[model samples]
Target: MFEACLDRGLTLKKVLDALKDLISEACSNVNSAGISLQSMNPSHVSLVQLNLRSDGFKIYRCDRNLAIGVNVASLYKIVRCAGNEDTVTLCVRDKADCLFLTFETESEYKVSDYVMKLMDLDVEQLCIPERDYSCVVRMPSKEFARICRHMTQIGDAVMITCVEGGVSFSASGKLGTGNIKLSQNSSVHEDEAVIVEINKPVQLIFALHYLNVFTRATPLSKTVWLSMSADIPLVVEYNIKDMGHIKYFLPPKIDEDSS
Candidate 1:
């Protein structure tokens, strides 16, 4: 059996909402540590990973490890029915085909339980090794989202260049060219700070459409980290408050003209 309760149901709702655009169904692994899910888009152009630590929950228990498959859209719908302040609890029997959800009002007045059928999604966990990136840029989540949104309006792709003390985003299309640069800001609050660390100058181009999708998680965190390296994928990570984090991996685009 596995059960976990969250003080705020809205947090779970937002997490699911952030993943709605990328994957439809996925398998969430429940263990003693917590719950985690990882899946790639249909085109495999992008991958998203979610982690929710056990210590962050109000109540958490896991007799044994279990893989719970679920439809992302369906779960989001059920969570949406919960009030913003309602407490949500997830329940699963030892070998049940359906996952149970309980929502309780803060005043301890109303309680609701929902049952959602689980699926048998063939999701294989990939081994992602940790390595140091050549450049890592930390900036406000809203700022990154806004830049991604605007860049898509001007071009299909955006080139990100990391220099000594700053990072730049540039896009070019038939409409025109647009460039935005941000230097390390030390005066602002840590959450709103823009800090760039680079071992060596590196520049890479990426599809703006996918980047815009990644910004869906902007609401989950105030700060976003961009980790990049030459001939490697860019890691966009958003720290989810007291819980864990959600990360998106997108590979750089190859310049066909240079080929």
Candidate 2:
């Protein structure tokens, strides 16, 4: 048997919405430690990792390690049924064909229950290696999403240039060019602000459409971290407050003809 409780049902809803655009189905591992899922996009051009520790949940228990395959969109739909202030509980027994969800609103003295069918999937877990990135940019998640949305109108890809000044996002097309520069505001002492760190300045091009889709995660966190390096995938991370974080790694766009 396995069961987990979350204070805010909307937290799981938000996280699912962020991944719904990437993959339709995934296998979630539930154990004593917590629940986690890592899967690559259908195109295999990007990967997403989600982790929520047992301590992060209000109540978490698992009798045995179980791999539960689920239709993410369906699960997300079930979570959406929960009110913003409602508490959520998920329960599933060994060899169960469906997962049960319960949502309760204390103030209103209301309760809701949902049962979502499960799936059988041969999900492969990848081994992600560590890397020392050359550039790390921390900025408001919404700002990054806005820039990507605007750039997509002009071109299909964007070139990221990170230097001492800041990080510049630019895209060129037949009509014209669009560039948005986010410079670090060192003077601002606010903890929730933009920060740009560069060890070795680098310029790289990536698919703007993918980046735009990635912005779907902006709702999960106020601040997003972009860790980039040459010839390596770009890492986008969002911290879910008291819970753990979700990370995405997208391969860079490189010309095969070039050395």
Candidate 3:
């Protein structure tokens, strides 16, 4: 059995919305450490990992490790019922087949409860080892989102070029080509400003749609980190306050005559 409480329900809401686009069902692992989820998209093009530490929660309890498979869409709908200041509690009994959710809003003088049926899922656990990417870019999440949104309108793929100058995002489509560059800033220092770090010049191409999908985290984090290498997938991570993080990995989209 386990019970976890989150102060602001919006954080959980954002996670669900971002996940709903790629996965319908998910197995959430609850343990003494915290809550975690690892899953791949149906097409196997992208993988997502989520972790929320126990201390991040106002109240957390777990007697034993538990894996509960749930319909994320239903869970998101239930979370939507919560008010802005509402506290959301997720709980389950020993080997219970249903997950109980309670929402409390004192100011609104409203309390809502929901019970969602769970399923037993057979999931394969993957050992995702740490990677050394060729280029790691840190920038404002909003700026990255805007670039992806605008460039996606011009092409089906986004080419990210990392060189001595900086990092650039370019796309070519029937509408013509679009490009956005963030040059290396050697002096500026800010938590939310654009920063680029590259060991050697490397270029990667990925589906524009996937990049746009990854941008769903813009609302949850001020800064976004992009790690890329030719031999490995691109890693996009968003650090949420008082929470762990949401990570995404998208395999590079390949084409003939593409470098």
What does candidate 3's lDDT look like per residue over 203-259, in tens digits? Answer: 889998888988987888888999999968899999978879999999887865854
The true-structure Cα RMSD of candidate 3 reads 1.5
Write one digit per residue (lDDT tens) for candidate 1, span 1-259.
Answer: 9999999988998899899888889899999999999999889989999999999999999999999999898999999999889999999997768899999999999999999998988888998889899999999999999999999989999999999989999999999999999999968999889999888888999999899999999989999999999898899999999999999999999988789
Candidate 2 lDDT by residue in tens digits, 1-259? 9999998888988899999999888999888988899988888889999998899999999999988899888888889989877999999977667899999996858999898888988998988888789999998898889988998888998889899869999988897999999888767644457788889998888998778878888988988999999989999998988889999888889854476
Ranking by lDDT: 1, 2, 3
Q: Which candidate is the best by lDDT?
A: 1
Q: Pick the candidate with the highest TM-score.
A: 1
The residue-level lDDT of candidate 1 at 191 comes to 88
Model 1 residue 100 CA deviation (Å) reads: 0.5
Task: Report how far residue 229 has shifted in candidate 2, in Å.
Answer: 0.7
TM-score of 2: 0.95
lDDT of each: 0.93, 0.88, 0.87
The TM-score between candidate 1 and the true structure equals 0.98
